[model samples]
Target: MAGRGGTQGKSGDEVVERGGERDAGGGGMEGWKRKGKRSPDSSLRHVFPTPSAFPLFLHMAGSEYGRTARDVLVACLALWSVTSLVVIAVWRTSPGVRSMERCKAELHRARGRLEEARAEWGRRREELQDLLRKSAQNQTHLRRQADQLTQSLRNSDASVSRCLQGRLTYSISRYLVF
Candidate 1:
């Protein structure tokens, strides 16, 4: 049932996984197709993997001309199929060449998203640091202003004491003369 090892081909009549892929299932031709069917919502269909460029070769091979073609044409298809199989095998039993390309594209997109998130986080952190620095500077300025006001009040008190002493001496001297 399985080819080379205990693993079986996903193309077996068992429909692989019905409509959707099990989380632990390995990659298979049928698994890829069924994964798309799991969703009922049309909008969600966009979430499923699209047929990659790899399918185009298979589609062309299965065309009407493919069947009625001459011996040379059949030979060509056989060669194409063999090459396709080799590419898929070397790539570690993936669906097909096109599918792998799609996977690569998706990975690139995910990398881009990660980079964007990193940039956003860095920007926010910098903003927070700046705000904290400004708050500290403002607090220091207020403390300096308070110290200056307290010193000015002390000076004003000393001046009032001297003025009162002068008035008292003048009044006492005038009473003695009377």
Candidate 2:
């Protein structure tokens, strides 16, 4: 008879022995076999003491509790996934999130405006420098023209004075000769 701690060794209808016990004949393989057959009640009595202990056995054989545990695990995982998704959605629609997005957009616009202003300043500076250069060239040209005009006026005045004096001297000589 197999106890609760030992395995039954043989197929049906052949007498199964417990823990490979030897028969009285002491034959090697033949003694191991040919043990008297036992009833099903006697075999199961050593495994389970009461009828309620059957379901309390190991759950590794695809029992009811095994399926229930798997279902519970899946449900918990699904609940966690839904909770995380809700949190993310709520955060995205929050006031702080919207404010942050607005600030980012404003910063980008400000940067673009600053760049445009810098470029305009560069162009205006170049135009001012060109105007200043042209103004200096014009002043130099006008000074040269004014100096030439003054020299011409002085030469004309000297020639006119000398001609008038010579005419006056000739008239006086004519008068004395007459």
* Maximum-lDDT candidate: 2
Model 2: per-residue lDDT, tens digit, 1-178? Answer: 3322223434534332322354454422344334443432344445766656532332211234554885788799999999999999999999999999999999999999999999999999999999999999999999999999889888887888788888888899899999
* Highest TM-score against the true fold, candidate: 2
- Give all TM-scores, in the order shown: 0.35, 0.50
lDDT (C-alpha, whole model) for all candidates = 0.59, 0.63
Superposed model 2: Cα runs more than 4 Å off: 1-79, 163-178
lDDT of 1 by residue, 48-129 (tens): 4465633333333333453356446879999999999998688875567668888899999999999999999999999999
Residue 142, model 2, lDDT: 91
**Cα lDDT over the full model 2:** 0.63
List the pairs of residues colliding in candidate 2: none
Give the least accurate 10-residue stretch of model 1, judged by summed lDDT. Answer: 1-10
